[model samples]
Target: MTDAHEDHWAAPVAAAALDARVRVPGSKSITNRAYVLAALAGAPTRVRVPLDSRDTRLMLGALASLGARSEETADGFLVHPLGAGGSSHGEPVEVTLGNAGTVARFTPALAALGDSPVLFDGDEAIRRRPIGPLLTALRRLGVRIDDGAGPGRGAPPFTVHGDGGVRGGTVELDSSASSQFLSALLLAGPAFDRGVTVRLVGDAPPSEPHIAMTLDMLHRFGATVEREGAEFHVAPAKLSCPEYVVEPDLSTAAPFVAAAVAAGGTVRVTGWPSTTTQPGDWLRGFLPALGASVRLDEDGLVVTGGSSIPGVDLDLHEVGELTPVVAALLCFADGPSVISGVAHLRGHETDRITALATELSALGADVAETDDGLRITPAPLHGGVFHTYDDHRLVMAAAVLGLRVPGIYVENPATVGKTFPAFVETWTGMLGTGR
Candidate 1:
């Protein structure tokens, strides 16, 4: 566990080549999705080896608020489904979303199935992220919502009044800002009176893999979802999963994989799934363009550093969450790199593109923010403070930069607890720097 009082972390520099094996925990995405599905299931579901990070803890609390209790077992959690019509005892409920986007977006529609009022609020950053589009769609589906931000300008600190059911039907949504907007409705669709059909009205949402993941999980839980181009139709069905085993989080494995590229050596991540809907799986294809040899075998995904790191042009709109760590790796490239099609990242935990540009430039890299992405040019970098902007991915990026750049201090390293509580220990241990 990271010390809560520690303000800054002296990121360790690799003294020699690294040849290490790392075992990452369960996926935050899968863990939270399992929590939601279990809560909506017909019976108790066992979520085995779920991620026990802050985001998942918040999801557990959110489910508890909705009257879906859970019991901790020796290996995982056994979740009880919410009662029929998802009704809580006729009293008002308050949910704390914290800074988890999964909780902020996914819980509202779940709350709409109840017969009481559920108040949704979050941290300061959540108040700035986009939630208006989903709220509007929910309202169109006849779910009563009280958000002071009128029309298309909704944020946190809102109330949902559920009259025991949702009159769900076809609704148009502009999910370009975040794919979660579409997923939020789909997850809760099966419980709706008429189910839900979502049509994409604007730019296609980033993170297409997440939507696929949602559909896959929905199917696993007995819900039938249909897809036609940019539209999705989810049919009403009872959800039930006797057991769900979460896979390792590939996104969290990014920085560790980049460590091989930054400090010449080899790194292997165990339990790499043969098939996954995770956007992080895209790393296997793109890392080679940066002069890294990546191979997936029976052992796992192994990455070996190349003699030289070359830059390449790439579009990452479909996998925007990988931007921070990829951007950090590019800072050490032999040539300039252009990462395009991820403008939606601005609406994330923080303005990730702007934060990356600012912090990378602070460390002497020539980073310029483009309309949709970033242009990073290699430069003589020195050690400096890398502010994380309360985003966990940013911490991983800082750790990658610290591999070669000495004196790279990370601010509020504890923020990584949002997804990986053992990030510091695991990272330092890989370099033989941990106690």
Candidate 2:
């Protein structure tokens, strides 16, 4: 394996069946939430084992822009809050999200607590992502938000005008576009004068597990949360910052686990939580259904790939982020596979549904774009350049496909820095190709 250049990667071939133990970094979702909650807390908070990546760093930077101070420790971060009624009474702060959906969605509501206007924007991809639901919800809670790009364009390049703080109460919105909308609102809800009561009045949001994760983190920080089905009531409470530990990212572990299943070997990732809200743990069932033997022993969750891969229908609404890895595995399966209930994937880092279809078809696989998901039929796949669309999931999925198909070059391989910065190093090392 060699670097053709900075932007391109000549994906390595597996010398043998992959038999190695790999450890992924901390969870991006958890780390971002910790940063948001810590900044809003009334006291100093210590975030332990937080993921150090582009997305988390962007969240930290956004918090710093809002007058929250953060210090880097060897293990993670030490965050000093700006009290309950935090405000930055200076010039408008510029927040660059860098194509991070979590940073873009969650920060706006938090920024509304500042004394000055906070201008929020990001990369080209971020401009295309939908921030309307969150922005509308913020407005309903009495925060002044101006969509600089204008109405109908429900994306970013906007500003949140803060008059010291917000008057939060009951809010209703349809979060089917993305669950991050609801999570974003709830994270910043506790700091408001009357707190927040959110009601889901339309189609149930996809990725329900992520909302559950948000609620769990809020409760961990001592916020009082009452849930009755689609309604959530959070009383006005002060969060006393406590030391927090982040778990390893199960979403980042998806590709590595997929590699083991596709290449015929056993792979175990350390630090699999015994109990957690991460939806990616659904891999425990998805992997086995795809012809892998999955077990949780002392080492961690281990998966051994079988000789034949099977195709099955799956509804990934609860765990949509795992779709790319599942799509990659199905490319080599014996029959057609249908993945449903993931229409929300259209607004991800890229239009993942179309991107996966385009890239997989580029490799000679028969892929059909469904209304809510994808249908893949096993076909003869040959080496081709897999376009990643600057998405971390696509980068990992293409790399997993490279384990079986030779000469697959991945475009913009460094896009993995958004989440797993050491993805290439860890992936190659697991296949015994390290320096």
Candidate 3:
């Protein structure tokens, strides 16, 4: 793995067509969700092939602070659940979120189930993300949080004073900024004394698929969740899972699949789930629209480049995490492409819409930022530096651009460690540039 603190990395340009088969690591989403569910499970649960990235590590660390320990196993991990009512210790514990959205939004609810006063803090960028709505919902559900940021200001560097139980009930929340707010409460709902009923108001949250993934995992863990329109009710129950197998991360596979499109070749990602709630699965549908041929066969999901990359109009709200790489691909399109319905990206690891517009524009692509997304037009491109703003997805996007455009230097390439720790090596290996 490249050192995340490295100054810059010269992204490798593909000299020939790619015919690579990529085996991405397990999903960070499933890994952390399993960690939280396992910690809340009634028995020790074995998580097989869980992702071993910085975000997952932060989750493990966070769970440990709440008195749940994970024993590393040959295949994955055996998570020991927290004691009833969580740790009885009255002392304070600290959790470092490290700019991970899952850890930042999900861990607080788990902290509310404990007796300790847990202080939640993370990287400077995390402090700027929108977590206040989730925190406010927690307060409504009877969890006391002190950030000194006042009402409606629920950024990190906050303290959750847990009295060992949550008075979970119906709480209205506006999850427009992030679906994590809803998933956070739902993940910990089974452990709540009265369970939780989340009534989402205002605009429907982007990434409805993520909420479905959460519900699916909850069901696998023996929790009963009922959804009625915009309201979801998670019944309080003892959760248990003997073992859970994680699927390969499709989001991480995006760049490699996109490389086939950019460099005019074929790329196959192994272990592609036949059916999944993963938002990355949306790629199979959208890639073809961008003039790529997609097929899911026994080998895996194969993507073959088309004759000419064409511009597309796409609404990526459900799969907004894909914007970075998709935007990168669009930069090489034959015509103009407009991406819409992902304004929520402003609150991600960075302001992705702005970041995409700025960085891609810097690389000579005609890019414009919209209220919710970006409009990208193809132009004669020459790359100098692509600033990643410490966002992992940006690194993947830059790599795709590098496949077609030479001399693309990625800044802080190590930041890809946020999810795909081996991103640099894997990407270079796909292009036959790795030592």
lDDT of 3 by residue, 234-311 (tens): 999999899999999999899989999999888889999999999999999888887889999987899999888888
Estimate candidate 3's RMSD in Å. 2.2
Kindly report which residue stretches of model 2 are placed more than 4 angstroms away from their true locations once superposed: 1-6, 83-87, 149-152, 433-435
Per-prediction tally of clashes = 0, 0, 1
CA lDDT of every candidate: 0.91, 0.88, 0.91
Better-scoring candidate (lDDT), 1 or 2: 1
Q: For each candidate, what TM-score against the reference?
A: 0.97, 0.96, 0.97
Q: For residue 131, what is the lDDT in candidate 3?
A: 92
What is the lDDT for 86 in model 2? 47
The sequence of per-residue lDDT tens digits that candidate 1 reaches over residues 229-261 is 998999988998999999999999999999999
Candidate 2 lDDT over residue span 1-435, tens digit each: 345545678877787887889899999999999999998888889999999999999988888888887999989999988643344555788898999999999988877887788888889999998888778888889998888545535677888887778899999988988999889888888998999999987888888878999999999999999999999888888897679999999999999888888898888889898788998889987787788999887668888898899888999998999999999989989899999999999999999999999999989999999999999998998998899999999999999889989989999888999999889998888998421
Supply candidate 1's per-residue lDDT for 8: 89
Distance from true location, Cα of 122 in model 3, Å: 1.2
